[model samples]
Target: MAKAYRSVIEASMAQNDSTIDSTIDSTVDSTIDSTIDSTVDSTIDSRHDSTIDYAIDTTIDSTIDPIIDSTIDSTVNSTIDSTVDSTIDPTVDSRVDSIIDSTIDSTIESTTERRYS
Candidate 1:
């Protein structure tokens, strides 16, 4: 009877040890897998976001900047040309006409005075 009792107790202890070891191994494996997956996913997401941001910024700089600059330059040049044409050309032309008229009138008056004298 004593030997039979000892054998049963030993078998039970062995079985309990096996269950404990299996549980610990399963829990540790699950924890490790979760941690690694989370880290990898976060790292990949961060890198992808950064890459996309860089691509957008680069595209804007390369594609849109020149177009905007050219439009602004064209507008400013056109405005300046229009202002000069509208404001200065007529003023200059009027002044030139007045000078020419005055010169011609003076010459005619001088000629008449000489003829009368």
Candidate 2:
């Protein structure tokens, strides 16, 4: 009877050891699966961030290009206006300047003739 009881107990112990080993294997598999999932999630997140950054950069460039062009145009226009007098007509100025020069020359000629006489 004692020998039979000992054999039964030994058999139960072997069965328990097998169950523990199976549980340990399952736990290891679960850990590996979790690690793989986390890696996938990290890759996806990085890709998403890169896409978002690219989109933002494109948006900023789109917004800045027009602003820069407009600023450049305004600056060029302002510089031109400041450098040259746009209000005065060139034709009128040339006529007045020519008349003044002719009057001065005539006055000088008449004064010289009178002094010599």
lDDT per residue for candidate 2 within 29-92, as digits (tens), equals 9998899789988899999999999999998789987899999999999888765665455666
Q: For model 2, how big is the CA root-mean-square deviation?
A: 6.3
| TM-score for predicted model 1 compared with the true structure | 0.58
Alpha-carbon shift of residue 13 in model 2 (angstroms): 7.2
Model 1 C-alpha lDDT per residue in residues 1-117, reported as the tens digit of each score:
999999999999999999999999999999998987899878999999999999999999999999999999999999999998999988999999999999999999999999999
How far residue 80's Cα lies from its native spot in candidate 1, in Å, is 2.2
Per-model lDDT:
0.96, 0.90
Q: How good is model 2 by TM-score?
A: 0.47
Indicate which candidate wins on lDDT: 1
Candidate 1, after superposition: displacement of residue 59 in Å? Answer: 0.4
Which segments of model 1 are wrong by more than 4 Å?
Answer: 1-18, 96-117
